[model samples]
Target: MSWNRRSLDRPTRRIALAGALFCGLTSAGCIVIDDAEARDEAEEVREDLRDAADDIAESITDALEEIGEHMSDFAEELGGETLVDQPIHFREFYDFLPERAGNLRRTSREGATGGALGFHMSVAEAEYEGRSGAEVEVSIADIGAMPVIGSEGFVEWLDLSVDEESDRGWARTIEYEGYPAMEEFRRTRGDRGRAEFTWFVESRFVVVLDARDVTIDELHELRDAIDTDALADLRDREGR
Candidate 1:
């Protein structure tokens, strides 16, 4: 029991002290670094996300502006009386628009790969084509929906008569780079003497007609006589 102070200090005691000190220091250092690094990383991620969001917002705004400008041009062309070739009243629904396109109603569709976006424009003739070759000369750009082409809708007016159930619409041969690229559906009501032609641009469908007191039978004749080739040619010209 009468041992020296130095000899009383056991190896186990020394090792224990060293281990505790090492663990304490290591843990303290780790805690400091982990917290700071975590905070920095979180901040960086937040900044990146914010930047991406801003870019996306800006892009969407730009696209909306562009779409709006195009729609305005289209409306102007369609609104113009010269294009209609008849003194007619127009009913426009442009005010009902998406938030992005300013004042044009734009709709987006989801597809497996991508999606489609579109707008609508409907026009009616004010006067009937008197016994003459009346034409609606819309710019290929307006209806074709080309990126950089004409900015007016085309015109078509005819005074041809055909039998009931007869397929005698206007005939014209036009060329397009990738046509049949689009399709045109025509409907005529012979009794009503009214004809309606529809052109679908991707998702946007434009219905063109000259139905001022038109009979169904007349519509059928006009439907049958829409110049498909002429439309194709108009589209081709836009490419040039």
Candidate 2:
């Protein structure tokens, strides 16, 4: 039987030939093969290949578009990159904690890395004690790029908007250096005693400062001592 392949691409011709051979084999020892039947089978095979290619290309394009939109929304919420590299080592995170800030002496330091409940993180932290029972605790946690599934994780505070106050304390969400932060202030023996300021930095690191018997200004001072620019440079920090 005569076969025409001049109008077809190389792959189409190869597949069409295979289809025709299968059709002939199915005839089961027939003496003569029908030319029209061979042509019809080849055409059908060519159409199926073209349809499959179109479907794959369409699926890929749709997937890419969806991913782009998803990442954009995620970045807007995070105020940084949608996806970063692996988390930095906890030892490296410790280097960001200050040993002393305006007379406060570091009393303790620790670092560790682990995962639980669908999340992984590396943490480094230190505590500083000053005169008059005042103290500051600083910590940095690297949570890597993968968003924690099955739980809100620590970032649940980012989605909050609380502004509550009483005679002795206040808890609210405030803005710090253009970042939405969580801060709480309470009075113990004096006007202002316990304080907490926490924020997510560089889209991957969580910076939290908890203090006791310190004024708000003192908290900000200790915060200013941390090299935030250097901390931000640690974005996408890669490690094991």
Q: What is the TM-score of each predicted model, taking all chains together?
A: 0.25, 0.58
Q: After superposition on all CA atoms, what RMSD does each candidate show versus the true structure?
A: 31.3, 25.2
Question: In model 2, where do residues sit more than 4 Å from their true spots?
Answer: 1-82, 116-118, 149-157
- Tens digits of lDDT, candidate 1, 123-188: 212222422222121111122332212323322211122223335333222222322121122334
- Candidate maximizing lDDT: 2
**Winning model by TM-score:** 2
Q: What value does the lDDT take at residue 195 in candidate 2?
A: 87
**Where is model 1 more than 4 Å wrong at Cα?**
1-36, 80-240
C-alpha lDDT of candidate 2 relative to the true structure: 0.60
Q: Tens digits of per-residue lDDT for model 2 on 180-221? A: 677888988776599887766655666778789987777887
Per-residue error at 148 for model 2, in Å?
Answer: 2.7
Judge candidate 2 at residue 1 and give its lDDT.
4
